[model samples]
Target: MPSKLTTVLAVGGVAVITSNPGSGMHALVQEHQMGILIEAENQQALNDGIAAAMSQDTTQFSQNARRYAEQHLSLEGVMRGYEQLLLTC
Candidate 1:
């Protein structure tokens, strides 16, 4: 068994893992702000999984998350009732 840590990305909606602070983790975190799941089975497996994710097309994942956020958490929609705050000096 191996130790692990799971991180949740609030904005990107991506989950990634690594056994150490390496390129596999670096790429995902840098490109997509992917949440980190750490210390998986071994360094190799963790690296491979992240690498596989990199190879696959993530268009559907991105689109779904974006659509959901836009509909339920749009900035404009969230601030609609705070117009007076912006006007105040």
Candidate 2:
């Protein structure tokens, strides 16, 4: 298990965590923690982990869809929405 003090940040439903390389995918699925892991051993592992995480719950991934829509998927309010999201981030 990771440290109790370990912080998991959800950036667009992607769980940003600090862990050893090649441990992201497992954590995402096995630990039910989605998003990206901090340390990926390689590009391939990162890609595979992303694919696995995406397949696990496209809907959950879609959580950011609204943000995208409010920001870029359309013309009006796109920049404003983006600025707001960025400010929050």
Tens digit of per-residue lDDT, candidate 2, span 1-89:
34221222222444433456456444443344334454545666667666766667655543543343344435576667788899998
Q: Per-prediction RMSD in angstroms? A: 11.1, 11.3
Candidate 1: regions farther than 4 A off: 1-49, 76-89
For model 2, the run of ten residues with the poorest summed lDDT? 2-11
lDDT of 1 by residue, 2-81 (tens): 11222123253445545355656555444443344456558767786678568877655555445534543467745753
- Clash counts per candidate, in order, are 0, 3
Highest lDDT model number: 1
Score every model by TM-score. 0.34, 0.31
Task: Choose the strongest candidate by TM-score.
Answer: 1
RMSD of 1: 11.1
RMSD, model 2, all Cα superposed?
11.3
